[model samples]
Target: MLPLSLLNTAKGHPILVELKTGAHCHPKSPTLCEYIDQRSTVDRVTYNGHLHSCDNWMNINLHEVICTSAGGDKFWRLAEVYIRGSTIKYLRLPDQIIDIVREDREFRERRETLSGNGTGRGGRGGGSGGRGGYNNNRGGRGGGGAPRGRGGFSKQQN
Candidate 1:
């Protein structure tokens, strides 16, 4: 396993894991890569989650991997995998990323449709259902509000 710190490196080339078992290399950190080459490819690749900045081009699985923060989480995730940094082919997604992407796409489509006429979901200019009434200032839903108990009954004090 790669160290936690290495998994999130924001400077050098990304650590590459050989598609075939037992081959790994860090193009930037040659020493590490050399060591990895001696190891069996079947070994699991481990890293601290740091990788070079997305500003630079990186090839992973023969695709360009664009790294970015996930929900501002401390760990970084593949934002977009491009064939040539412009044309996106596959998305390197972590678990649960699908929902976020789907939600974003849905929101954008709803906004566009709403702006076109007077129909759509929450977004700017779509009536109360639009972004009009929703408070931008409001943050995420966060944790659930005060928990509710059975039927309208409140917990009795001892």
Candidate 2:
């Protein structure tokens, strides 16, 4: 599973995002943190932390953040922090989130298997030109075994 996919599945969970702002160079600085939720979507992040909040709320850009910290470490607070996606070095998620994502993936796989469409193979079954199946009269195989090329290459008429 991809990192983003795992994050999606970890919605509503607490996450520690480490930014590439070069803050890690300082071993005593606090990073940014967020309580993952539905609003945790990228581009715009809604969170609560030490930063002052306007109207008891804060919205941050995902591309402005430099670094973030998670877990019991007080190096950082939950205040709203904005970090550029490119500046993000990595994200720390709870172990349970991994399990949750795994279960969800397995469930989807099972569902697709039960429906006979989980093989990832394109086209339909009965050989009727499924989704992206080729239907043109190429004369390859399937369909009507019409001759080979477009009109056999006649002897050039001499």
Candidate 3:
């Protein structure tokens, strides 16, 4: 879970909130906003690539987020906010952060499997590592960064 300080950065109108709940947290039930209003749950609000809630809506730029509120009334401070644009064209999350989160989730699944949490049946597909080997080889097939390493597209070898 993200820290409280990160949410403070989103203190204005037009905020994008990505409600990530824990294992006990219900994603099907009332949305985070609604949950907050109904049960006063702490919500993580992300805006402008920052994970923090602002004091007021007027403090930040309101014209950049695709805001959404689940519940009606709640004092849930921002926990994490990623601002893209008027609709968050693209959320620029650090690769390391994404990897860590994915790895943690994978670990939990492995633990469950080892503890016989499943019915001895084969589990779902594993290894969803995105763009992993792209950083290694600069050419061939998995070319991602570039060829010359000068920040430009490398010619693909047929």
Candidate 4:
């Protein structure tokens, strides 16, 4: 099963989408997309593209796609393509994506440290506190040991 959150994070990012190729991953049987595997014996086909969007079913829309045939021999390009999630064997995301997500999380944590108002999660906004971010009683704004998520998203006034 694919992690939809991670897939969403991949939006506007480059991805290598390997379609189900002749049961290679399955071992018992090969299921291939007729459009890409018309030859019937092609071992693999991959699409290098920028992810545009995805639906609840994990179906994806890609733009600026480049299709590569088995063993990296032949290549063709498409302006855009839509891929059904079921036909996808796996998706390869860039190494930096993990770092990007980590940075975003860290930035929020730092903001929480700065918000200083012990109101609630995103204290100023009454937002859904992120990940166990509820503390009923804290002294007030500018206090130490500020709970994480309490001040998240609120602008700090220095």
What Cα-based lDDT does every candidate model obtain?
0.33, 0.41, 0.36, 0.64
Q: What lDDT tens digits, residue by residue, belong to model 1 across residues 13-113?
A: 34332132343343554445555555444243333322334433433232233222212222223332222222222322243334545566678788866
Ranking by TM-score: 4, 2, 1, 3
- Can you write out model 4's per-residue Cα lDDT over 1-158, one digit (the tens) per residue? 23676678889999999888652222221232444445756555688999999988888988998877777866767777788888888889887877777777788778866864443433332322333223432222322243332442323449
Give the least accurate 10-residue stretch of model 3, judged by summed lDDT: 123-132
lDDT of 2 at 119: 43
Question: What's the TM for model 4?
Answer: 0.57
Q: In angstroms, give how far residue 115 of model 4 lies from its true place.
A: 5.7
Which residue pairs in model 4 clash with each other? 22-30, 23-29, 23-30
Model 4 residue runs over 4 Å out of place are: 22-38, 109-158
**So what's the TM-score on candidate 2?**
0.45
Q: Which candidate wins on lDDT?
A: 4
lDDT of 4 at 132: 28
lDDT by residue (1-158, candidate 3, tens digit) is: 44222233223323344443211222333454455445444344333333433333222223333333333333333334333223222233444554565677678788866764223232221222112133343332322333432322334569
lDDT of 2 by residue, 40-99 (tens): 333322222222211112122322223323333223332245434554565666888889
Error of 3 at 28 (Å): 34
Q: Which rank order by lDDT, best down to worst?
A: 4, 2, 3, 1
Quote the lDDT for 15 in model 4. Answer: 94
- Candidate 3, position 80, lDDT: 40
What's the residue-level lDDT of 150 in candidate 1?
A: 17
Better of 1 and 3 by lDDT: 3
